[model samples]
Target: MSLYGEFSVPTDAFALHYTLEQIQEITIETERVVATEVGLTNYFWVSGCNLDEFETVSEKDPSIQNLRRLDEFDRATLFRAEWTEQVDAIIFAYLEIGATILEATGSHDEWHFCMRFDTHDRLDQFQDHCDDQGISFRLTKLHEITQPHTGSQFGLTEKQSEALVTAWKMDYFTTANVTLADVASELGITPQSLSERLQRGYQSLIANTIVVTPPSD
Candidate 1:
C-alpha cells in the first residue's frame, strides 16, 4: 500500500542554508535538485521585505549559484536558485527510493517534508539511506493513503497552522465577540498582515479539505 511520510531534515544537511538564514517566512517547494542542476521556482515569501533586499541576501550566499525572481505577489515571490554539490546526494536519495515529495517548507534551521512512497518499505529505505549517510532526520508522521487527499487534507505552513489553531481556541471566529485585531496582537503581527495570512490559510484549507461535486447533466 502507498504510504505517506512526514519527516524533517535539518538545514545543515540540505541546501539553501543561507537563504533560510536571511528570511524567516520563506517557504520552498523544490521542483528539482540534482547533481548538475537545481530549481526551486516557487513563491519565496517574507513578511516585510522587497525584491532588492531578497536579492541582496541571496547574493551573499555562495552555495546559491543563481537566484532569479520569476514573479511576485502580495507577500511572496517565485524564485529559482541553483545549488552546489551539497544537496545532490539527498535529492538523489529521494529519487533512489522512488519517493514523491508532496510538500516541503522550512528555513535555515530545519525543514519539514510530506512525501509519498510506493509502500512503507520504500519510506523505511529512504530513512535508512539517510541514516547510513549520517544525515540526521526526524520522522513526524507515517500513514497509508487509502484515498485521494484533497481539500482539507492539505497541510498548513507552520505560521498558518499556529494562527488557525490560536484563533480557533480563542474563538476569534465567533461573531464580533473577539476581534481580528485582538488575535493579530496576540500573534505579534499587524491586523492587516494577520488578515492576509488567515485569508490565504482559509483558501488553502478550503481548497484542500472541501469536496466539490459536479451537477448531473
Candidate 2:
C-alpha cells in the first residue's frame, strides 16, 4: 500500500537559504516541478515580501539559477527557476524513490513537505537516502493510504479535508466563531498554510461539483 508522509527540514538543508535569510518574512510554496536532463526546473509562489528585493536576493542564492518572474498576483508572485540538484538532497532523494510531492511550503526557518511513496519500503529508502546524504528532517506525519482515490473523489487533499471538516465542526462557517488561526492551531499548521489549503479546497470543490462543461455543438 502507498504511504503519505509529512516532514520539515531547515532552510539551509534545502534550497533558497540565501533568499530566506535576506527576506525574513517571506513564505514560499511549490507550484510545480519538472525534471530535466541537466537539473530540476521549479515554479514557486512567493509572498510576504517585495518582488524586487526577492529578485535581488535570489541572484545571490547559489542554489537557484535563471530565476524569472512568471506572473504577478494580488498576494503572491510566481517565479520559475532552475535548482542546483547537487545541493538539494531531499529533492534528489524524492526523485530516486519515485515519490510524489503533494504539497510543499517554506519559511525563513524551515521547509515543510508532504509526499506520497509507493510503499513502506520506498518511504524507508527515501529516509535512508537522505540520511546518507547528511540531510536531516523532522517527520511530522505518516500514514497508509487506505483509500487512494479519496482525494479525487472529493477534490481535496487529506490536509484540505481535515481543515475543512475541523473548521465546520467548530462552527467556523455558520457562526464565524472559530477563526482561521484557531483552525490552523488545531491542525498544527500555520494560518497561512491552512488558508492556502482552504482556498485550494474551495476551488477544487467548485471545479469538480458545480462547474460543468457545455456540450459540443
User: On residues 1-217, what C-alpha lDDT tens digit does candidate 2 reach at each position?
Assistant: 9888899988888788789877999999876566777778777789999999999989989898999897665677779898984345656655677777667788999889888888888888888877887888689999888874755344455667788889899888988667999989999998887887777678557756787652342
- TM-scores, one per candidate: 0.60, 0.71
Q: After superposition, how far is residue 127 of candidate 1 from its true place, in Å?
A: 0.8
Error of 1 at 64 (Å): 2.9
Q: Considering every candidate listed, which one attains the maximal lDDT? A: 2
Q: Write the per-residue lDDT of candidate 1 for residues 70-184, one digit (tens) a residue.
A: 5454765556566654454356545476676555666657877777788777777887878878888798998887866432235455456678878888899876788999999
CA lDDT, candidate 1, residue 54: 65
Give per-residue lDDT, candidate 2, residue 19: 91
Per-model lDDT: 0.65, 0.78
Ten residues in a row with the worst lDDT in model 2? 148-157
